[model samples]
Target chain A: MMEKYHIESYCRIKDQRISLNGATVFESAETNFLPFIKEAYKTLDTQYPKFFKMDALSKLALIASDLLLKNMTEKNIALVLSNRAASLDTDRRHQQSIEEADHYYPSPAVFVYTLPNICLGEISIKHRLFSENGFFVFEQFRADPLVDYADGLLKMQRAEKVLCGWMDLDNEKYDAFLYVVAKNGIFTHSKKKINQLYQTS
Target chain B: MNKVYLSYNNIVSGYGFDTAAAVEGIKKEDACLRQIHDKHLLPNHYCASKVASETLEEAYAQLRPKEAHTHLEKMLLVSLEKTIRASQLELTDRVGLIISTTKGNIDVLEPENPFPKSRAYLGQLGEKIRHFFGFQNEALVLSNACVSGVLAIAIAKRFILQGTYDEVFVVGGDLVTKFILSGFNAFQALSDEPCRPYDKNRSGINIGEVGTSVLVTKKTTHLAEESVVLLGEASCNDANHISGPSRTGEGLYRSIVAALAQSELNAGNIDCISAHGTATLFNDEMEAIAFNRSGLQNTPMNSLKGYFGHTLGASGLLETIIGMHSLHQNTLFASKGFQELGVSEPLNIIKKTTPKPIETFLKTASGFGGCNTAAIFKKVAEK
Candidate 1:
C-alpha cells in the first residue's frame, strides 16, 4: 500500500480567532483585520520587526505560517498558497493612491504589496525557505489544488516538505488556513481532512 | 511518467493575432511598444505595448459571441479559440485548464466602468474563461506575479503526468491599465525608451500587454508541426526580497539548476536561453550573474523585450512560443535593442537574426514577491 502524506500541523485564523490543531491559540476582541492581526503579533512578542511593514494579506499569512513553522527545523519546505482577493485589499489602496489627479502620490512601498504572492515572499524570508513557491488564486478556500500541488512536489522529491495554505484578505472578510504536509503525522493529509478542519475550526 | 508535449498555441498582442504575426514583426525588428499619451491609462508619456480594444473586438466579432466581454476576456477568448481550433480537441473531464495572469479585469474596478467590482476577482475571471468554453474541470487560476504564465505550463505538465488530466489548456494575459502602469511607474521601473535587455545603456523595462494560450497534452496526435517536449521545470523563491531581485541571483540560479537536474541534462544541453530579461538594471544584471553561474555565459541568448517589451504574466509563455519557432526554423532571433554588453558577466547575446542548429532551450521569469520559475524544453521532432 502506498504511504499517505500527513497533516503534521494545521493553523486556522478566522472571525478574530486563531486555532492550531483545533485548539484556540489566539483570540482578539477586535473585529477589524488590522487590529486583530496586530494583536496576534503582539502576543508572539517575536523580534522580527519587519512584520510592521507588511500589507494586510502578508500579515495574516505570516501569523498562521509563524504558528505552524516557528519551531520546525525543516528549511526545504515549499510554500503553496491560494487566495481569492489576490492582494485586492492592497490593490484598492494602490488604486486610490493614483485615482485622483490632485492627490496622486503612488508610494512604492504600497505598490510593492499589490501582488498576493508577496506574502509568500514574506514567509519565505522569515523561514529562510528557498524551496518551491506558488500562489494560486481561487474563488474560495479550496483544498484540492493546493494539496495536489504539494503532493506532486513531495512525490517528485522537489521539496522535503510543503507548507500548503489559503490566506486571503479583502476588507473585513478574511480567512487563513495553513498546514504542513509531511510523510507522517497525527492526521492524514487529504482533501476531506482539510475541509473538515477549515469548516470546524 | 507520461511525456508532456506543448502543442498548438496562439498569441494576441499589439503586434497582431497569432504567433506567426508576432514572429513576422520580430523578424523586421519592429516593436509593438510606443509612446502612450492617454491620461485614462497613464498621465505621463510611457513606452508600453497597449493592444487596442477595437482591434481585439474586430477579431472577436468573427467569433460571434452572445454578449459583450471585458477587454482581457475578449483577448483570451480570441487567443484560446484559435489554439483550440488548431489543437482540434474537445473539452473533456479528463482535460484541465489553467489561467495565468498578474491581474485580471482590474480595470473593471475603476469607478467609471460599467461592470460590477466583483468581476475584478481572479476566480470570476477563471469562471468567465471556463464557462465560455464549457470545460469540465475547474480552471486553475495562477497569480504568482510575472511567473504565472510559464508556471502555468509547469502546473499543467504535472497534472497530465500524474494522470489527473490527459491534457490541459493553458491561457495567460494581463492588460496595460492605469492599475498596472501607476504601480510600475511608482517603482521607477518603466523605461522612457524601448527596453534594451543586457545593454550597457539600457534604461529600464517597458510594460506590454499580451494574451497567449497553448495546449499541453500526453498524446502525439494533433501536435503542432514544431511541438516541443517538456523536459524539466522548477519554481523557487529568493527568500531575500519581495520586490527586488536577489543581488547574488540565488533564487534564479537554484531554479535553473533544479530544472536542469530534473531533465537529466546540464548547461551543455541548453542550446539557447529565453531569459527573464526585464531590462531593468538590477533584473538584467541578476540574470547575467545567474546564467554565468549556470555555465551558460557563452550560450546564444536574447531577450525579446525590445520587440514586445516586458509582457509581465504573458512574457514567459509568449517568449517560449517564440523559442519554439526558433527551434523549428533553426533560427536565433536577435536580442533587439541590444548594442553593448552591460552586465559584468559575458554572454553571447544574439545581435542579429541568424541560423543555428538548436535542439533545446530554457525559459525563465522572475517577478515581485521574490518568485522565479525555469522551464526547459527540447525539440520533439528531432528527438
Candidate 2:
C-alpha cells in the first residue's frame, strides 16, 4: 500500500512581496532586492545572524524557508531546490574581482557561494537538517519532476518530509516558491497541485 | 521497489581515455599529475591532472561532427556515447538523463569569449546534452559542490523506486578551468606537488579533470559483467559551517550510518572503502573521524584522489567506477601516496596492491558547504 503525501505549507516571494499559504505575509515598497530581503529577515526576527553575510540567493532562500518551515520542528526534511540561473549573479561579482589585469584578489567568501547549492547548506545550518539534499538546475519550474523526486523520497522512507521548489535569482530580480510535503495536509500531492501553487501569484 | 543495477560505465581522465586503459594504468600504480604552467591559473606552476585538450577533441570528433560544443560538453558526450552504445539502450520516454557538475562551461564567461553568455548557465548545458542525445525526458542537473556526483546516483535510484523511469543515465564532469584553479588558489587549497592523502607531509589538493558515466537500470538482461547492485545511499548536512566541515564529522557519520542501515548490513560486510580523501588537512582528518565513528576503522580503505587528483564533481563517480572494477578484479589498488597516519584516529589504509576476494564496498564523499554522501555497492554475479 502506498502512503499518500500532501503539501502541508507553501510560500512564494517575488516583486518585493511575499505570501504564505495564499495569504499576504509581506509586501515591500522598495524594488531593490538587498533592502527588501533584509527587511523580511528583520521582520521575521530570525536569530540567524549569518543571514547578513550570505549572498543574495542564500538570503532569499533562507527567508522563504524560514517562513514555510515556521512552527514546525522536524529537521529531517529533504531539500530539493532548483534554479535556472544558478549563482550567476555572484559568479559575475567573483569574476570581476579577478578579471582586472593588475588588481586581482579573488575572495574565498565570494568563491564559496559560486555553487548554487550552498543555499541548501545555509538552510541546513540554520535548521539543523541532516538528511538527503539536492540542488538542481532546470530551464523553468518543472513541477512534475520536482513532485516525482519528492514523492520518491517519501516512498523510499528516505525522508519523512521534503522542502522542495524553485529559487531563481539574477541581478536585482528574484523569485522563490518553496513548499513542504508531508504525509497529510490540505492539498493532495499531485503535479497539478504543485504547478498550481507555483503559479499561485 | 525495483532493484537498480549500475553498469556499462566509462571514464575519461588524465591517465587514459577509456576504462580499460585507465584501469590498466591504475593497476600498475601509475599517476598522471603533471606540473601546470598556465599563468591564468597561478603565478607558480602547480601539479594537476588535466586531460589533454587535443585528446578530448580527437575522441569527441570521432563520435559527432565537430560543432560548437564546449570542452566539458564534449567530454560528457564522449563518455556517455561509449556507455550508451555498450548498453544498447534506446533514449525513450522511460529513460531519464542526469548530469552532475559544479561549473558547466564556466569558461564561457571569459572576458573575450565567442559563446553566448547563456551557455554559462548549467541548465543550458543540460539542454545541450539532451538535444545531442535526443533524450525524451527533461534532464536533471545536480550541482551541489563536490558531492554532486555520488548524490546523482542516489537520486537516480530513487527515481527508479518511484516508478518514474526504468533507466537513468548519470554523467558527471568538470574541467580544469582557470575559474576553478584561481578559486582554489585563493583559498590556499592548491598543492604545488602531487597530493598525498593520509600522509603526514600532505600539503593540499591537486585539482583534476575528468568525465565519468554510469547507467542505472532495472532491466537485468543486458547487464555488463562488471555490473554492481545499487544497494543503499544517503546524504547528510553537518549543520555546522558553510565552507568548512564539522570538526566532529557529524554529517559524514550520519550519512554512512543511514546508508549502512538501509543496506541492512553492518560495517563488517564492507570489504573495502573508497573514501573522499582530498589530501587536504581538514578533509582527510574529517574522513578519518567519520570512518572511525562508523566502526570502519579496520576496513581496508583507500582514497583515489592520489590517482585522479580530486576531480571535484567527477571524483565520486569516477572513484565508484574504479571500485566496481576493484570488486570484479579481486584487487585492491594501493592508496597512491599514503605514507603514514596523519589523523588522530586509526585507519587501515590500503598501502600496497593486494589481491583479495571482495564482494561489497562503500563509496563516501564530503564536499564544501558541509555536505556528505555515502553509498554501498555489491558485485553481482553474472547469470
User: What's the C-alpha lDDT at position B114 in model 1?
Assistant: 89
CAPRI band for model 2: high
Index of the highest-lDDT prediction:
2
| Model 1: docking quality category | high
lDDT accuracy of residue B224 in candidate 2: 86
Candidate 1 chain B minimal-lDDT segment of 10 residues: B35-44
RMSD to the hidden true structure, all candidates: 1.1, 1.1
Query: Model 2, B1-383: lDDT tens per residue?
Result: 46889989999888777898788888999887887897876676788987888989899888755468988888899899999999999999999999999988888888887888889999899999998889999899999999999999988988887788999999999988777888888999999888999989998999999989999998889898899998999899998888898899999999999999999999999999999999888998899999999999999999988888988888889999999999999999899889898988999999998999999999999988789999999999757
**Clashing residue pairs found in predicted model 2:** none
Q: Estimate the lDDT of model 1.
A: 0.89
Query: Which portions of model 1 miss their true places by more than 4 Å?
Result: none
Q: State in Å the error of residue B110, model 1.
A: 1.4
Please provide TM-scores computed only on chain A for all of the candidate models, following their numbering: 0.97, 0.97
Error of 2 at A184 (Å): 1.5
Question: Candidate 1 versus the native: TM-score?
Answer: 0.98
